[model samples]
Target chain A: MSEQDWRAIRAEAIESLLVERGLLDPADVDRVIETYNDRVGPMNGARMVARAWCDPDFKARLLADGTAAMAEFDFGGAQTEKLVVVENTPDTHNVVVCTLCSCYPWAVLGLPPRWYKDPAYRSRIVREPRRVLAEFGLVLDDDVRVRVWDSSAEVRYLVLPRRPADADGLDEAALAQRVTRDAMIGVAQP
Target chain B: MDGIHDLGGRAGFGPVEREADEPAFHERWEARVFAMIGAAAAAGAYRNADQFRHAIERIRPDAYLCDGYYGRWLAGLETLLREAGIVQADELRARIAALGGDPTRPGGARPAEAPDRVAYPPAGEGNRRSVAAAPVFAEGDRVRTASFGVSGHTRLPAYARGRRGTVTTWHGAWVFPDSNAHGRGEQPQHLYTVVFDGVDLWGAAAEPGTAVSLDLFEPYLTAWTAEVDT
Candidate 1:
């Protein structure tokens, strides 16, 4: 616990205060920090989307078996274990919302944005998805069929955002970098 | 008995505001509370995730929405820990005082553990499990959700109750949350994705071709008959 932990002094001080206050324990605090630090976030989901866009085989496997295909990229954990990938197309747009609560695929997209968890979002998205999406700056065509997926329970859904036109010459990594968390959540286009 | 937590299509909560870049834990206390709940679950302090959610659902309607997200998490954690006998109420009070906050108001009484409480599972796997029973409804079948008010935990949203919709897909049978929350049993039931026309749920004001498709358990729905009730 010496020079090995650069902020050992500060960390120890905070832990001692927390323990003294009976709010938490020394070891549990460490575990808490560890969990937050290991997050794979939307970048991991982006990698999956980019690879899928580049490879038909990967795309088919991803659309068919999200969990297994995800494991191929070595991204597995709590909520990531069971995921249903919903793809966004020109004619049909898929939007994901957990009206009951903020039940999202955290493994791929990370912790839901505060907006996603807001009661306003949970309530309105299912009822008025176009209005909600428009507020998010995503305006769909009147012809496009908007499918709002209310993940009210177990299986989570992640949108495979349509690959952008300018992405013609980009490779997998560049395409992955272009994939934003909002796009994966189906509120924005990549 | 429809709790405020069942909010799906009620009105005027406000607009969704997106933050430019949101961090996982906004405050140190938030992180601590989040980890404490996880650790408590890891230490067998509570029955299951549904039980924890039920505890949150049981929060007073006024405070349910008032207690912000992590604030509700803190409140719920306090309630569960005290109820499970893992931490004393006074001990929590003292800690709350030490943190310069009032502990006297900690979301009311300490809830009791479920009568059928069992040992926690090894992994992070939740109460969800497979049910081998045949489904009563299938994709493309019109079904009407049962509009029963529950005095206890339920996954059915208030707006969808009594509305009729077509089953878009049968998501197999999964652990029933309503029963699982009470330690009644896993009681796995068929889960389906039901799609409702906007007007069916929201009346004539809804957009012309929009619809809301939600995943729901079989217990929440009934077979819609074509014959009109005279």
Candidate 2:
């Protein structure tokens, strides 16, 4: 009688029904989950960010055309058909949210975090971003312009976080390790 | 339609809960539901993300709030499957019963699928379109978002309705979700990145030096005229 039990059973029932009807292949379902859970995720994004940080030429191309630039790394599918990279600078800080729905860059970031889909974030981030970012432990200077990008359409956004203050000596691989998913999402500094 | 899914600027919601080291899915069922949607899309049950989202938007306001993210996704999947005739109401109940679950619960039996026709874009092709028509508004054009009180799905959030903003970037042509969600063909239009000043949206309560940007379709905007100013 528990709700969790119902959800589990209901999910099972639906999958089985689809499998029985030959509309869906169970293997395909497993493949899809594995693709997002394993193959695709924020690590791919970090690698791209790290590449951008190390290679000025690559960064210019990425800032100009994110979808085409990322295609060089063979990263384009599903939610990332149109990828737009927003850079974070000392004068301007950028963050992304899907107010209408949880429209995230799945190919780059795999899946969105729970807080990204939470009603609290959906409702308040655009209105009171300073407070929300502060809650996320990112306090912008009063002069830094805060730009919140609402992924209202198919154009997905990935925040190109500024290189950390102490990251001058790090290589691309080492730099990628320092990039957290939240920092790419513009909630924290890399 | 104005629904609970449009949670842009409403107040009283609590602070966001940031779970440390969160997995993609909290439970196996949630992952299954997530894959179920992807599988359904692959199986030709749903056309695009817009259709899938409209199903989620169709959820009742009360249930919309009660059901978590994947929970709503599960509900939307059930709705889509039932509409596609891939699943039947009786079969769902029987499966629940076979699984030793009570079928009388409110979540078990869902509302009937829409009587409206379904529209599908070419498989592997998303909302993007190649139209020869020029963009209605160019970048830096001062425009106002129209107050489109559409009865079906829309991307224009409640907070930005009738608000004035400057077009910062043009995103080329894309399918308009309002028509696409209701079995209408992909009405591709010019999409732009419009930047609205925080003060323009939230008035004096806005944080200083803050701006909100949205990817708005051409249909959702009009050229701002000084003659119409208050």
Candidate 3:
């Protein structure tokens, strides 16, 4: 059998072991998977970002204390208990990474992307963020101060990418459509 | 510990690659492993979240790299199961054989659980803790990260060691991973957002007009006196 096949069998064996011991129920596992896969993800973050773009007061609260501001939308949970939102101004561009582990803001952004968890990105982004971001097709100007936030502790970071110049007339929902996961991660512009 | 899992500032891993249309999970096994980890934690199989993280860090360097994210997670879960005395090697082999795999494959014996470790908090209880003592350093204070040689789990990355930075924001107190990873109680400490100049971290190789910010706990920092720079 292929390595993949063996892995599947190994996983099944462990699951059965845990179930037999009353430590786990297959139904509970399914519920956990569905929660992250469907109920949580980038859309939650996009809605918050869209509201910030449209409303000045919400944006002020979000930048001041992301964890408290998220309560207004009833949107904070696991992996984001203490949320911190960094804004990207014309002179400053912000990015987020976790050098120790893939400590992502899961409540808002869902599971981290493959690249976000990859060793190359983890190792190099803090040392050379401009080059790393450039490789992701985001070439920042030399004058823009790049701020790389490494979430080493419990506090998780979410980058509020600068709203595009052309998105002036868009409504909150329309503005939300432009906020992609990569943009919130500070690798792309919405 | 300065293990292979601490990848910050190390080079030669190559460029970051993104999938064309990356799914939330690459495969069914990945999803199963993810859920299994949650189930294990909920079952009180782990002392704390830090202990689970240290399990993955304890992986043999070569083997750790061989597997992807979920794969490393699987290895960690197996390690936890064995260490907790919940699963034995013979049982694993027998189950594998029953499921039609080669039982002759080498497997190590189960390890005895550490008797001195602290118990994990109930499933939903987070790491946040409230303390009456005020934070040592306030926002806008110049501080220097403490340089220590610890052979245990620490959130302080090697790249940021011994660097001088400013406390940009105070995040209140949080569970210190170094103590918690060893089955120690949650010795929560004041945490802050320290922003360091890129040049201070990377020296000549740093990009101009760039800064690296880290959420650091109080024990990792001290006041950066002006005399220290001179």
Candidate 4:
């Protein structure tokens, strides 16, 4: 069967299970699912970046205590306990991956992009970070050492992307324009 | 199944695929829970956000129980409502059917909210004690990967441990919660990295031009010099 056909079948099966078990009303599940697809994603991280750009003290706090620092902005949830924030500096670059599974900082960063959870990206990036970054349209100089973080159980990370050069004088929204999800993941720089 | 970080060097995978509009189920639940708690607090159901926050805060530290705690609360609410005849199983099913397809719709029996709050205790709090900064080495300093016995979850991959390399960066002192998280919280050590030549990792058979780096935690290393001690 086609992928769409399979999805339809899966949805039907899930609906049947929900009804039989009476775990949740299907309509409620639908609504919850919609909100998730619409509002969540790297946009969450982009907001964090914009806040960091505008506030130095908060940024310092973010680097020092990532979970607490993020709490000031009201960004925390279940699965956020293992949070560890990594920053990018002039000489060092930070990229995050879960080679085993898609363990991510869901609370602050929202849900991860599909590419992040892909097996292809997970398996190859750690061993060949430079090559993978090149494919993502990022080409770093040999002198700028590349450090790939293998985020596993107990600790998950979010990359504090270096601010973009062209974003000077831009307000939060405008600065947010430059903070792409790729930049946060260290695949690309803003 | 292998733990999530074990995917490196595996074969038969295609190039990465990016999904434009997809969110995991747990994340959706988290957001919905947050909103529900926020709205409830706003409605004065709880004395203050702190009260609600305190309730959750008490349970957040139990890593294993975190996920199931919310699930149980939701289940308990539904059960009470059902037992009191406020809502029937068939009625809930019918409402679901009436809503039709499109799971992304807004408003329904399902809650749409984020958690009340998520907190990570301050560094070196509770069971996590701060480690005194070890002056092992500095960036730009060349060092060799010390040969050490391996057990537990280590940042040092088997392929690169016990290899020689240069110190490219210092990651600062961490709680080393790997031991704690794994129920082996005896000694939480600091972690670091030393970038090895690709030749050192893959041996002489490796391509001469390539280079590799390994982030070695403090416990995995010892002092090294260029000259042989013998």
**Residue-by-residue lDDT tens digits, candidate 4, B83-111:** 33444556545554554533332211222
Q: Is candidate 2 or candidate 3 better by TM-score?
A: 2
lDDT (Cα, tens digit) per residue for candidate 3, span A108-177: 8998998898899999999899999999999999999999999898888899988889998999999999
TM-score of chain A of each: 0.84, 0.97, 0.96, 0.90
lDDT of 3: 0.84
CAPRI verdict on model 2?
A: medium
Error of 1 at B71 (Å): 0.9
Model 1 error, position B156 (Å): 1.1
- Docking quality (DockQ) for each candidate: 0.36, 0.77, 0.73, 0.19
- The TM-scores, one per candidate, come to 0.89, 0.96, 0.94, 0.57
- TM-score of model 1's chain A: 0.84
Look at candidate 1 and tell me the lDDT of residue B47: 64
Off by over 4 Å in 4: A7-11, B1-5, B11-14, B19-230
Clashing pairs in 1: none
- DockQ of candidate 3, scored on C-alphas against the true complex (2 decimals): 0.73
Return whichever of 3 and 4 wins on TM-score.
3
